[model samples]
Target: MSYIETTMKKLQRSSPGQPEFYQATEEILQSLRPLIDKHPQYLQQNIIERMVEPERQIMFRVVWHDDEGKVHVNKGYRVQFSSTLGPYKGGIRFHPSVNASTIKFLGFEQIFKNALTGLSLGGGKGGSDFDPKNRSEQEIMRFCQAFMTELHRHIGATVDVPAGDIGVGKREIGYMFGQYKRLNGNFEGVLTGKGLNWGGSLVRSEATGYGLVYFTENMLQAHDDSLDGKRCLVSGAGNVAIHTIEKLYQLGALPVSCSDSTGTLYHEKGIDLILVRELKEQRRSSLIDYLESHSDAKFTPIDQYPKDGHAVWRIKADAAFPCATQNELTLADAKALSENGINCIVEGANMPCTADAQAHIIATGMHYGPAKAANAGGVATSQLEMAQNASMIQWSFTEVDKRLQEIMKDIYQRCSETAIEFHQPCNLAFGANIAGFRKVADAMLEQGLV
Candidate 1:
């Protein structure tokens, strides 16, 4: 067996029951055969073995009380996965799905995703099983305060910084920042995704979605195609999907569908962005609420979805963007997309596609943008926010967006060029994994064993 295979088997044995972490590790290791052949020094140094392990793992208890005076307790975690490149940087996801395996998988993915940005940021991820949905503002504030009480000790501007993910957003960041400031008695860039009046960067909210579209545009342009006049289907109505639809409209693509946890909403003419934002962002309601205003749109609940696939993927479209949760697009969903004639697929969410589904899509010769490369925009802009905070200079929206565009373009070029160099042209998933792994592996080798 090869060095990568041997190390992967060992990882699976050691980290048993962590299917998500194992899945991510296997995907990257499988794509790294060429790198292993080219650099025996990496194997000699045991880089793969060390790289699979985190530098530190922190778990704590978060206790808070709701407005009704009911006390609650939840587990919190922060996995400082790697610091080969720079300070540990990633987002803190707040949802019931948060766990050791979930955090480890996300931290592991962030290591490569941050590397692909060509930015000076390492990898880490943290969160709790605290679901923010349906929680009152006061309850959320109490939870954030308690969560930051412990997190504040482990993070700083130049040490380890966290932004937001899933259920964590501007409100959560604000509450956490307030607590951090109270504990430290100082204002600093300890976290990104802050309110603009404080230290957040412009376009930070729109970065991931816009970057996904930007990367897709680059991919299409490379193939003599464009997003103009393309029919697109997007899943999730969160910040990522919302901005993705906005950018699609800007690029002359018609986004016809968006979904939430409850169901998928399909509008044949085009998605009403204003209504979607109102339903999701402002009201924190389901897609079913969207139909209250626009009765012409169709809403298919989760139970009504096809037996083998999601309703979003069942809809015919020129491109598909899965911006929901991990492993959302199954192999059956990929077949449905291919049969429905999806020309390209880009992931706005981390690891939204299953390995089998990803392979099936690639085998069909569709343009596929892996999450590590496509979703790096959000973290890239977060780093930009850190830069602004350090300098005490807030840039305008146009300036920050221009820089984001340049960075996305540069990342796309690097992935494309690396794929060609490695004789895996147009195989972006393989190219991204190889490209990201090489940089971190070389850095680890130079720094020696920790």
Candidate 2:
């Protein structure tokens, strides 16, 4: 291995907690490997080590009374990754999978994602290991009340803002926001993704998914191509995947397949957006239920894709968006995508591709868009929600969507220009790392060894 590779491998193994954090840092460091010689301070200041670790990691116990009058306890966490640019801002996830390692990696990724948005919000993530699935409304409310009881002290409108993530949706946000209001006794924008009647922005829900398509559209245009006739595969049946499909349809692209944790469904013609929305949002049922409703669509377990590789990456598509989870796409999958002539990849989920998978794409000269740059649309629109809340105004969908598109285009340009300036054209990971890192690093320099 080369010196840069050896350096990154050494640093990666020295860290503690989730393997995902090391996976994420190794991807960024590999991309930025060429820059260390010129910017020796990156090594001297130990920015790789400092940046890979969260500034503060808070874990606490949440105890609350259930509707059954039973007291239950759950683990909660808030990882403040970086506060270089401004106050901490990220979403709070409530899922069975949430833990310190998961939160740490997420918070670490948020630093760059927030910076890429050109917003003055630093990076942080908070959440609990409480799964809301299949729970009664009262039970969810009780849990949210309990979760916020402990989380309320650490967040504020100007301090750290938390929004919806994964298992935390509008209902969860409403409960938490109400608790925050009750505790603070003032109407402050401490949380986003609230109901429109409250203070939520018009396009916040669709921002991340739609923004992924918008960024992908720009990348395609740069290559003298478009999404018009491309066969698209999007993983995940959640909010992000659903809306990403919607926007892809709007832009004349045919999204053919989507998956849930259970299985993947492929429609040879195209996925019906209305039916999909009803099945996912209204019914909150399985993707399998959609298959039962539509006999024409084919349902296959995640492992059943025809190719001998990861199902999501093995599919023959003009484009692929992995909206599922971290490290979902493995290195072998990356090699399959390269062999299949996959045109472009845009991450709709945080750190969806493993470090080796990312390196495979970079080595193959494929168009790769990192999560920090591609997924900034979510936080960018979240910041817009904060602005709307502060001003007591709600923008129309067209106006908000137009701004989202503009921000995505701006992100594309910034990454592109940075890549070119660094003599690594089309290397978006490098562009994003350097571009986002410079902003936060400069802020840290100004703050002076805090």
Top-TM-score structure, candidate number: 1
Cα RMSDs of all predictions? 0.9, 2.4
Off by over 4 Å in 1: none
TM-scores of the candidates in the order shown: 0.99, 0.94
Candidate 2: tens digits of C-alpha lDDT, residues 239-273: 89988999999899899888887788888789977
Error of 1 at 272 (Å): 0.3
Tens-place lDDT digits, model 1, residues 254-322: 999999999999999999999899988888888998888889999999999888678899999999999
The lDDT of each candidate is 0.93, 0.84
Residue pairs in collision within model 1:
none
* Candidate 2: residue 244 Cα off by (Å): 0.4
